[model samples]
Target: MKKTFEVSDRLFELYHRVHRLVNESMTEEGVSLARSKFLFFLSKLGPCRSTDIACALNFAPRTVTEAIDGLERDRLVMRKPDPEDRRAKIVSITETGRVVLEAAEHPRKQLLEEIFSALDDEELDALFDIVGKLVDRTDEIRKRKDEAEEAAQIAIAR
Candidate 1:
């Protein structure tokens, strides 16, 4: 394997290791990483519909509904009729949810800090720059792939 492949593999393993540690820490505080994402979104975005959460999180409506149901059952979130659309209910984080979310966030942050503290300031800056470039390239490739697929579909239709 090329050095690039080896580096990629190491990065992948490191990511999973870090993620697992963070999840474990958060779980000890009574929240999973997935649950934290929803709580964080609601805490930041204020009240919104399940459909809104689905779009924002790139989850299916059913998945968001199920998650919201669980959160509601736990008294982490609440739903009420939307003022603008009576047919839809808006979801919001309760004070209890906020408290739990904050608690969960602490362990996640602590774990990340412990992991990244291995890197000095200069190394951290370089890593951020490299990661940004990789993300940008990935987005560009995805956009081109999407456009190519769209063009192929158009050609086939014609």
Candidate 2:
């Protein structure tokens, strides 16, 4: 008998393939996924601190520092002392960064549009609905996993 979970397996495969495509496309432009994400975030959110960026990106402070260092070195971003907080610095994208981001936006959107162009409107809607459901389910799973780990630690300590 054939396995029943083939659809799920195929979904996972598609997910990985899409991720690889994005990485490959971005890599050709000489940027990693994390760097691209940080640049995009900075473009959207204006100046933000390293700590806020780390939390928003779900990265460690050290990792954020490394990315920021590279971006600053590349002249894509600048770190200025936060006027409100003397101890902390905020990162701001440079004019060059804005130009790069604007240039990247069209190609990225075009690529994704082409990828999804095969689907009809109804299919596209259904795909989005399914993705939303999956996101909710994943969030619940993460919460449960965290709670389970906490419970296990408590049990071991008692």
Q: Give the Cα lDDT of each candidate.
A: 0.94, 0.85
* TM-scores for every candidate against the unseen true structure: 0.92, 0.83
lDDT of 1 at 51: 99
Model 2, 1-158: lDDT tens digits are: 24537878888898788777766766566665567888899999999999999999899999999989999998989999999999999998988877766666666666688889999999999999999998999999999999999999999999
- The ten-residue window of minimal lDDT in model 2 covers 25-34
Quality of model 1 by C-alpha lDDT: 0.94
Q: Report model 1's TM-score to 2 decimal places.
A: 0.92
**What is candidate 1's lDDT per residue for 29-118, written digit by digit as tens?**
988888888999999999999999999999999999999999999999999999999999999999999999999999898888988999
Runs in model 2 lying further than 4 Å from the true structure: 1-5, 27-32, 150-158
User: Looking at candidate 2, what is the lDDT of residue 49?
Assistant: 98
Predicted model with the maximum TM-score: 1
